[model samples]
Target chain A: MNTEIQEASDILKVIESANKLKGAEEPSGVLRGAQNAWDLLSDEQSQKHITTGSGDLNSILGGGIHCKEVTEIGGVPGVGKTQLGIQLAINVQIPVEYGGLGGKAVYIDTEGSFMVERVYQIAEGCISDIMEYFPYRHDKASSGREHLQPERFLADIYYFRVCSYTEQIAVINYLEKFLGEHKDVRIIIIDSVTFHFRQDFDDLALRTRVLSGLSLKLMKLSKTYNVALSLSWIWRYRCSNKLEVFVWLFFNDRLNTKDMQERRNIFVGDDRFCVLCNISASEDHDHLFWPCPFRRSCWSSIGIQLGSHSDLNTLISGVKDTASAGLFSEKLL
Target chain B: MRPPAPKPPLATSTYNQQEPRPEKPLLLLASSRAAKLSLGCPLLDRFLSGGLPAASVTEIAGESAAGKTQLCLQLALLAPLSPLSSSSLFLYSDLPFPLRRLRLLAPKSRPDLLDHVLVAAVHSPSDLLSLLSRAQHHLAHPSRSPNRLPIRLILLDSIASLFRSDFDASPADLKRRSGLFFKISAKLKELAYRHQCVVVVTNQVVDVVEGNTGNTVAWSSGRQVSPALGLAWANCVNTRLFLTREVDGNGGSVKRHMKVVFAPHLPERTCEFVIRRTGVFGVEPAQRSNNSSEVKAHGYYLESDRTRKGGSNQHKQCTHTSI
Candidate 1:
């Protein structure tokens, strides 16, 4: 825990070839250096969230996202994360009169991806929803004073297009003051947070530290301001990892097999190997176990009565039905 | 005077060019109009505490087409008004410099000041290193123009472009690439301090690690991708500014805000401005300068929503002019 002891230990690790720290000693007392964990808890704590209007997302997130916490959404390209972002920005503008948080939004588009036309469409949908529920009491509202134009809700939201990570970090750090001045503003969204950091990172450790500092600022702003901070990160297919790989793994197998003559490929059918036999074949889901020679041998070797069935589901039930006491008995294993 | 005072310490001096050189740099008097670089944008000048400070590197970072080069063009046009001669160095590192925009922003009178500006394209980090030398050599011996014009400002529009595209930094080569950038920064700092000219470097941004940076590091605060070029280059910077753009209405007119991210003398404040045909101009938030029907120039900074409640002082003399 002591400063000198920590440095000594770090150097010892580096000397022993257990760790690799680039700089001998990191320059201490940089901007917003490491703080006591208790310092953050000293501030007021509240778990309030403005409804995003979409019931499914709100429910999935346990009664909408926490305004006091930062939510980072990452996905492959063309995932419609920006669409969801724009919808949330528009949805956050529901006035207090209509069972909604009367709050404004700030959308920071780093990659020039924020579309005004899309925001307009979403804003119009929100206005119609508001009008349907909280219908104007005055019959001659049009002639009277009340006017609901699409621009009204759109005006409350502010958008910032940032090119560099410095600007991205700057706008985020300065957002505290912006939020304070514009008290009504309650949401901040950045489309594709990793757009700039993908290419040139001259110093990895330094970039991590700087990124760590900026990340701290975003969370601090969200908590202090009690506003939702949502940012989306996009990755291409070639560099797919994390969520992309997770999704791809489950969805990679195809259900239907198309015509082999039309498609320009050497393998006739699916060109997949059955896990049972470990041999290549024109494989689909049904052929993986049943109907195939490898699967027939696997079924016969186990002494489970194999029968003719139209599909895999019926075949599964056929085995289950015939194996009454046999299910309880141990197999060849 | 005083034989140019021995070129004090690579850019740390606030000597205000008083040590003297070939061309007598303007006296950095508080009252003199030439003391500050105008930047042609009044709100920017006011926010910047009388424009960019001399003998320091000011980074104007933003996204592509965030009016960085536009601001650079404005600075080049107003370079003549700086403490020294009208000349400047515009190094296009990413893409070709927009000559049409430069010509448009150039002052009709003293069009030759445009000629005083030297333009060069940087291919790589090594290329940039050589270009820096060529700039110094050219400044030392004038051959292009009739009269010697000491460059008072150096604009490297998006300095990260070439570095990002060319260099690939693995753990083995990280030291080499960073050392190269450090050398470049040292030279730039020397250029800035010795000549007492402004060095405005533009850098592109990147995304913070999504699930990566947060869990590994000590982020009780949160996570974000730090700006590009890392701390190696960040250590040498004097002032860092960020430009963020946002559209006001369906009309698609963007409102740009300039934030002083880090600087010894400047506060971290963001001021809103609009880009017009002439150049970038500051706009009052209440007025929404781009939109006139909702707001009139006559109105003050009163909330539009409060107009229905308060009848008193419905009309007042405008204290500020926007755009």
Candidate 2:
């Protein structure tokens, strides 16, 4: 072969070897659009999970709530979907030494169900539980070594009560920025996530588009941030007090005047019935929630068996700070 | 063992055959089976294999107070089982919010989930029909709607309640209303399939008299109840579940039976459940196995036939030993 040709071929070989070395450094240029599986495995952010205390629940969830995912809780009215939402919100606040996620909660309340009094009660219960059993654990944070006030949980929780659908959309849209501002926030909870979609919007087609956008945004947020987005929605159904009481009291199925009336012709509204029980009393929240003879009997079953010497007002209203109050409020929420 | 044989010269066609390097077929990453939302109730979740399948219509029917509404609420709460979506639309016709009763029945679940539900009521069938179209439009998009499932659930508390109230309306109008009803169901099915949202509709049941219990046969059961909506509505559902109360002779349901009457994917079977302050659960709380697929492989269902099963018996034995 000619000397010139040989020299040119040698240069080509050297350039090819250099290119192969460069390829090994990055591998297929995939680094531009993708990542190395080894790096992904070690990324750490994708593996975080926030646990709900109920083992049964965690088991069904694959691994509790994935910190980098959205978890939705769906249920009908009176099914305590919100109660679980609140439970997780409060459970997330537990100190890491006590088997909690040990982070603050962001609660978005749309249905007017968030009770601050109820939150105080939950915090009190969680704190007492921590103080009682968490001492022996390695958590110096809660061993009176670290000055962490129990009430600090309440302060750490960021709550947004968006009364309208627009407000809800606005808050969710900018939640990423908010989370960036608050690095300590671990969970974002929207109590009854679907309230405004049903109530405010007459344009459901538009609602679906908007909802789909929000869902996509939430999905993206979960992927990008190390936070769990938990949504809880209540399925409220219209039921009369008479049927409810009968189902509670008797174990048989019998058609009532209302059922028969509806079966024969039309379902007319009956307002005189007590909202809580069919025991023939005026329907109201205070009566239904606490003071009624039936409600009092139910409360006694919980623990603080309101003794004859105990005042109902004190037991119902003045009950706070005590263990019984914590129990009551915890159960109430 | 020996010197390598002289290599044969490549045929002219060997390099000319246009051999392109094989590449991994553009991977279409997606769920092997359809994506589903968990119901959060193990018995029910297992019965449906992790919850309601997306892009399908699930009809829940039962007699009044048969806990049809309760199951709906459970699904509404369980929609969070889908990590990405948080929207649930609960359309009520005329029922009041039984908050007090719910507090008792659903005591353990978080109280805040109720706040996220979007609730609307329709007084008439037309109102319901319009509401459904509006919902459809709300989720519609100009381009291909998002591939990710959105609007976790769209519920019609009693999709047939207003239709049942059409008894006093003109026969011709009732016919038109019933026709419109089918349209809503069709539109709902399309939305479900397209958006992967769960569309659940609660239906009522009517009583049917059995062969008469004459004096000669006084001990026999007298009546049987069946879902009310006729064949037209039946064709629209991907899953039809029948719920009934298990009365204890004192006029109360000690338990409820959620029977899969029919489904495109599931066979007929019934699971017994009871409503508690913690919501609806099976007679036995479902003990979750870490290898969920192993449990599913054994069976995601508790079939009546399994009482006679052979392989399943060994699984039962394994469970006992594990405990």
Candidate 3:
């Protein structure tokens, strides 16, 4: 017993001495603080830069969502939420000069709304001007023409459709394998998360529980991959009226009795309807972002104010100018 | 023939006169042979330094029928019988098509390759995790050394399907799903490092808003939000390849064209390949000329004279084309 006690004391002494040596190796006051500051300054430039498919959107989002954080875009149908998600994927994959990421994008479609043909159309529009205007062209003989085939553009985009929750998990595992093999992916989009959950789990509590789990997973993934993640959602019925009113006010200068009457007619008696209300609003991208009543409120709620009845092109231009002005003002100040 | 023993330590406070030696640096023996086993495509094999590095994950993402699965199938069939060493293993989980289709696709693949390839029809993420853990155990046994048995490649087909099917795409659900995917990928990376294997996964794309126009049309529609799995999968991968389809103008007769869109630490350009009867092979330079009238070439042609004998190498070189 005496020997055992002595042995225990000896072990304790060794441990204490080892710890003391470790502590003594570092001078712990101002030097430690200086070390931390140096580390922070050195690593600041290497921080991840996320590109939210849209230039205006990226500006609003402060250079896209931070890597490994969740950013939700919720609105009624035809409000450009899904469109924003898809654009981000393509833009994220594009080179930086084109106001894109030049990184890979992963997309999971839950609402059966992901259309590959549309992506090609957008790609054609985006790249055509660049190809035509760029003056640096070698001789036709030296320059190979076959590489610009539309099929080539289509091949750069990846697509997936999910109809159930189980398939969602499978897709996740597949994504894990993909990231393991290829590490340049920087953006991920999920079109309308509510459909899968709404279809599979009926109970709200269980649904939220499942959603929380998914949210945490995405957050971790973004951090691990250093990628920006965006999720689309369909607003529930409780928020539909407010959305409708908001849209009505944006389209009509005055939200008087006639506009309310038109809104009433548009909404009708259908309590859970995802209808296309304004004919003009449904036509282009500008109307979808700033004037589309159903989504206008969402943008405002997030502090992105929009002018009444503004078209998408004008709204984007306005947003850009405003953002630049803000930046310029900050620089001046 | 034992050496003479030294005297015991004395209770003295004096230090030794000999100088302290610096610790030997840890030397990792990265095998070129192992890398060659993972990349089945000859052009890709050469482009990616023989093959993908072991202990890292690679992502192959694309739309449906964009040849993502076909690529996976090619790797599965080629990994085990690769010239690197004997007794390599390939694992395929959560495949969309039937296992029979994989067999049919690679009919000419070696019988031994099929024998070593393990296909698991996983229904849930938990099941996949459990199987992966078991695989790690099998690969990590000390008895399984380099010359004995080497598990070189692992492939997971259609990652989006697995997560999208099980979790709602709600922000909350996506976060959770991505977290789980990140965890699994972390485990796979650890396993790869410990066992010297390459892990590959395939992902699907989504439609979102475009950046310039804020439009949701097919052309303006961006990409789908990958469930948390999508993001997590991207995070853990060491390289990423985005695949997309295009119309091959075979003199007005449209053919499906598959090209690589993105890869990390790789050239940011596209390369064309076709999944033919023999398997995924690079299109010959002669065939490429036929399609040359459409657009200027941006990426370097991955033409191998060794693979295609008596093939013409004349092709126009342009690096400005955006397609």
Give the per-residue lDDT of model 2 (tens digit) for B59-137. Answer: 8888777788887777676664455355577888747855565455433556555554667888876687677667666
Measured against the true two-chain complex, the DockQ scores of the candidates, in the order shown, are 0.01, 0.01, 0.01
**Top candidate when judged by lDDT against the true structure:** 1
Cα TM-score of candidate 2: 0.37
Model 2 gets an lDDT of 0.56
lDDT of each: 0.57, 0.56, 0.50
Going through the candidates in the order shown, the clash numbers are: 16, 67, 117
Off by more than 4 A, model 3: A1-333, B1-34, B86-97, B107-109, B142-149, B210-232, B248-264, B290-323
| Angstrom error at residue A305, model 3 | 67
Cα lDDT tens digits, model 3, A1-333, are 999999999999998787666665554443322346665555544555565534576677776665555788885334446556655655555455434455666777654344443344444444553355443531342242344434444455555554344345335435554565568777667775654443323244434534655666666776574332211111111222223223223332323222333443643232222233444332233443445576666666655565554354365446546666444222212
Question: Candidates ranked by lDDT, best first?
Answer: 1, 2, 3
Candidate 1, superposed: residue stretches over 4 Å from native? A1-333, B1-35, B141-146, B211-226, B248-251, B285-323
Write the number of the candidate with greater TM-score, choosing between 2 and 3.
3
TM-scores of the candidates are: 0.39, 0.37, 0.40
Predict model 3's lDDT versus the native: 0.50
Q: Give the per-residue lDDT of model 3 (tens digit) for B1-323.
A: 11122222111111111111111111121242234454566666544435555555677766676677777777777765676443434444444455675677655635555665666676677777777777766765535444344566777875667677878868888766765665566556556544556678787766543342331112111234221243335444545666655553455322333333333223344455666765676554345565654323423333234332111111101111232
True-structure RMSD, every candidate:
26.0, 31.0, 26.1
Q: Residue B85 in candidate 2 has what lDDT?
A: 55
